[model samples]
Target chain A: MRAPGGVGRRWAPVLAVLAVLQCFTLLLLGLGQSAHAGDRPRGCGQPLPVAGSAGFANAQAARRTNVNTYGAAAIVEQATASQAYSGDLASRFRSGEGHFRLTFNDTFGAARLLTLCDDRDPGDQQTVMGVDDRDRWLKKDRLYEQPLDLYATNVYVSGGAQAIGGFYSASVTQSVLGYRGAMVAGQVINLYPAFFAPAVGNWQRGDGVASYAVDWVAGGYLDLGAVAARVGTAGANGLFVTVDERAIGLFGTLSRGVGEAQADPLAYLRAGLQGFSLRRFGAPRLSEAIGQSSLFFRDMPVGVDPSGDAELSRLRTLHLDQRAIAQQVEAALSYRVGQQSGLYDVHLGWHTPGFYGERSDLKGSVEAEDEGFGIRVGMIDVAPRYSLGVQGGRYFSARAQLRGEAITGMILFNDPEQLALFPFATNALSLRLVVDLAAGG
Target chain B: MSRSPHRPQRPARPGRLSSRSLSWLTLAAGLGCTQEVAPDRFCQEAATAIAGRTEACTGDLDLADARYAAFYEAYTCVDVPVESMGEDTASPIAPQDRLHCAFAIRNLPCSLVEAYGDDIEQYMTASPICDTLVQPKGGAR
Candidate 1:
């Protein structure tokens, strides 16, 4: 039976093909021919405007975030080690029999699954890593700074933006595994170090005495430590992630007590949380962009022919990467609500110790009691999309971000999966003046 | 196993034991020998005819395109030879392969390429796979 107009025409062929293929096995797409086999893909998104202090040194090479992030650390101990190579690396990479290729649709995993049916909140790519950082390091490459040395001169470029924001705005963006939850949640409340705050002097509605510096409203929070660890270890070809074993805690408390501490019923509640705060070694630059070429060592087995001419089957190349790590934790707190004179966003979070994603870290945030109450006017956490693609949770970013949009900024822990759609993660504290329109409102 | 003296096994004696082993084997070998004597016998001719035609059509002498070759080596593939009444395939080149080959040899002298440059190109596209034998060869287009 045919339908009316163009609809029927389009579907008729498809229906016929499906019906024929279903009945006759010979009409398969591949006809049983195996797919090409070689290497798994390396994935990295756009630059995240999350790290205000970080230079976009590697934004051009998003995949290389891990490599450059580790810098001299990757060779801290490997220096002076005897170098040895047996054969051409590529030549040794013979395709295994029966190996096949597999392709993943955009936004595949938990996040996509959750948002698959939802019309709003499309996921997208964010957080770029590339620039001056080449994926190489001597046994001891010097740090990057003024009075450049032999290591810094040949190691990194002077271009690229810094990472500042995170994932929470991954709107319809797809990954190999359908936006699996990498870093989906966090909570932060601080006025300073504000990478994405509105311009200070553009006060359209307030006086200097009681000014509104910034306002944020986030609803999803994914685990940054888990995400940093997972995507960081994607391949030995990029950066390396190391979790500290020390039982360090991230303790933060924000309290405003008045003249009489005991009699002040208006004493702001003090919230403190302690644990390990994770850290990550941003990967090295990936992909050839701008004016750049990746020099790779070709390894092909030497083949002999009857005519004395050598034949090389195929050429294979490997891009090596080196990295390093450090210990640090990021924590923030404020009054849950605005006081008579300022803003307050009180919160409790559990974090593990050190650099990027920590191995052991459990963090959660308790939003202000009246955040979603119908009576409240500034509450916007309705039907939020989490990094896990879960509904009704605050979106959070869990990695150092390098947002490329105007008003650029960096976020320490933006969920790649969630921010794959939303630009802000780590906490539901949605802020104003974000380049991503989705997060601001 | 013991055999009945009265009803001797069909393949046990009185026949070419070298040619036949058992009832089933005997039948298969019998057919084989029959074809050797009369090679054109339908069943005997079918297998070689089917195989030769496929190889000839493939044009490739080796595993150059292993991806496509795997299809032929597949367990489920079927084979059928061109019947005497079947269209003459002695042309060596399939109609389509001919056009592609012709275009591939464009500009070469005394070849289909020089004779019908535009026409060959229109039919075979600008380039043809290196193996086709269209003319003026030298791995034309």
Candidate 2:
């Protein structure tokens, strides 16, 4: 079933008719070409052996050098209100993060496979040379002096081999400052990879893929790297370390042709399950608060001990000391015809307590000067997300996706009063648009 | 070898050949037909080879001899300029240098960077690759 570019899934029946018509048209075109050739099609006799052909060589060179530029602009609207400089409650808004990515892919070794199921054919081994740069600037509300900037570049070589029963693929990358997925200024999204430390802050990762057919493709991956956890001065003031800032994830997908191939608009129904566990251990460090440090504060308030006598004077920094594991399971029904694609899916996710909490400990009895300075390790819940993704275009590609998460947990609200005022976490609406500069129509 | 009695010998036409001569001629023709990779194909292969080496995992410095082969091949084919990093140079002739240089910058080991940095720097600074990014149509170096 194929529908108009960017059309929603509600028009599945129309798309099915269009897809059948398109296929018929393609069949007629193929028949005409064969009739004109006065012979059956056989890849025109292997492209006349490309070696020594200047035009062929030039085409190959062009493909190798082709650079695809991608521009993405996203705006996130959250339910929370901002209380920045003034105590006045201000409607908080997260506006723009403009990202530019340059991607170059070199294909060689074997002819490209048409589908993941092509692995069963054992004739379409391919090697891919990929490199990309992702750079972005995030604007946040009154938290830091400078806008948060992220720059990541990676070069990876991936090769896929079609073997008996299936195809196997593997790749190793040397990356410098690489971060993947949706990353917000103060938000950490679950279910992704982080690199191992000591490789370079840029981090390196390896991924493997196996596909027996379109219906059965599986992947497992791991990334290791220490992420810098900053404690704001209004809260705890210290630079702490994450002992286990690593992530490991596994995902599997199964898709099978559904309905009558010729009459039913539903072509394939697919489902995927993925789970990830991320753990970070932060070590406590000794630090001082205002009016407590004898060297820093010359005029101590009454009952304030410059000699560390006051219980509130000693503030030691401790992190949430958390191990978070989150799981996502989703099933999507897609309608595709021509070059247009539409997908509607039901997404379910489970998040453990401490998965989203960032807290620090106050070692002394005076209680940490910051009101929010402890961890809540007892909350967990499952939430459902409804999302729609549409993609259209032949050469230059455009993809728009919208996902809404029904809030089931108020993890961001710390104070009981605040929780009472805002019984649920703000509903999050994420919208993103990506434009590919080097697409062909 | 003796000719078969049942085979009647035909008169050779002018410029025609005996069996032995025909065999030699065919052999010569086949030898001359040895396939040579086209220039564009060579460049692509060179880039892929270079990328392969660049992506290979090396600890400290994988100084393995094979690793540099692709880099050297790319350097040779892409015509890396002898000019210094900031020196003005002509637009790069080999477009693959853009891809290869990106690999070097993003994935190359620090040890190899020390060895190859000068060349990579020179090429990237004068690279037409960057210029093509803004062009309505780009990719050709």
Candidate 3:
């Protein structure tokens, strides 16, 4: 199905868009420059945990688990192609030297960090994250640290079932030239692009079944809590703090992801039918100040109003309702005794939920076992929600694949895109493979 | 230019064919083939094969693979194509092909080789790839 007038050559102008963007970030990183006295922003905090080391201990781990369960990973569901990118950089391991995540509890207290935004853009981001390099291997070299005080939210650029590279947003990756953040450990995120079709996921609450969050003012106020997991021994624990943009709203979002155990399938399934919600709030001034420290992933704010203007109005950067907020989630469950595939994960979600006055939702998707992969289908019975999705990609090996659709409909209520020339659409496809770097002895 | 004190001295030239074999190589690798194969064996095997047979074969598409992440590793490697005209004159690469250069220059200045990638036809061209490119710091000295 071709759109109107000759669209083939129209793609001519698309060649350098990604490269130009890459360059823009490069220029921001200033790869060739040296450290300047006042060049980099100062927002780095202490390092986080990596592969071998337990990241969040008891209290921290538990707190993070709740956030994850309550839907933090879901924020990374949908992403766009314009910014869908992921990779990593590493310093060879020394006996004592290692890598880490630079996370700051405060904007100015510590060093630099990754600043990701879950903007109000209707649909345009594929991956808005900076992940640890894929090169880092356990006992070899991987990410040693994460950015401090970063705001990461997943958005659906194109809805898909597989979460290969869905979450999209930019983050400060490196420092200006020679100036490294004062924090000992460096920071980097592997911003890979996910490819898959979009549809309602597994679990879904009945229309208005889940209670919506309470309302709050758009100011310096933020909701935070600690998540702790058992670090090495019972003696210590790892900590992860969840930061949400708004205090309330009930909207669902979508993404294409795969995992040993999809983060939380039920959460995603529920969101697919009921989109998530967002109340507008401006990025913290400190968020920007912290970002200014590094050249990599350094993006200047393009503040504007919904009326197609750059005038900053309303308390929060812009008056955001239901349209602007979105999500991306990766959920999987992995136990040994794997039969067909070494690891099998029932990817239950990655959807945009309804947040504007709609009740929480109940949604579910089923992957029909067919060819090497399966036909992915899903539905939602949310009170009021509407979205579009199409995904096609490989979940595990290049041979074992998944290529088909399951759902595209208005789940519960009103969709804002009634009059737009084309309704919102999300599409994806990915072929994955595995390679052995080190020989098994 | 002054050499850095930390940089290792270049190794004396070894057998031209000193390279590793791709035996059932899966894709998850991140490093280019780092197996320490003796070049003599590789050259001998090639010499034994007929010239026609050699042309019919294309080298492995996977570079620096890790078993666990072969799929991801392949996705990460970029393929930048270029043409070598006769007498050292090279043609300007297509804009799409030049993306590797842009990527290497952008956000990843240090990984020019990884970002720019190997020419698709170079392996078949039978040029001394090992002799031309320097070994990355991780390889055996």
| Top-DockQ candidate index | 2
True lDDT of residue A316, candidate 1: 23
Per-residue CA lDDT of candidate 2, range A1-441, in tens? Answer: 434552344234333533443453344333322222211121121111212111222222222111100000000000000001111111110011111111111111111100101011113222311221111001000010000111111111111221101111111111111011122211111001111111222122212111000001112111121211111100010111111111221111111222333321111111121112222123222111000100010111111111121121111111111122221111112121111122211112223222222223211100111111112222212111000000111111111122111011121211211111111111111111111110110
DockQ of each: 0.00, 0.02, 0.01
Q: Is the docking of candidate 1 incorrect, acceptable, medium or high quality?
A: incorrect
Model 2 alpha-carbon drift over 4 Å, by segment: A1-211, A214-441, B1-38, B52-141
RMSD of 1: 33.4
After superposition, candidate 1 runs with Cα above 4 Å error: A1-324, A327-360, A365-441, B1-141
Q: Model 3 segments beyond 4 Å from truth?
A: A1-14, A31-441, B1-141
lDDT of each: 0.19, 0.19, 0.18
What order do candidates take by DockQ, descending? 2, 3, 1
- How well is each residue in B20-138 modelled by candidate 2, as lDDT tens digits? 45434422221111111222333333333222223232211123233333344334443232111221326433222333333333333445534554253232332334223221112
Error of 1 at A276 (Å): 11
For every candidate structure, what is the RMSD over all alpha carbons to the true structure, in angstroms?
Answer: 33.4, 29.0, 28.0
Docking class of 3: incorrect
Reported per model, the fraction of native interface contacts reproduced equals: 0.00, 0.00, 0.00
- Order of all candidates by TM-score, from best down to worst? 3, 2, 1
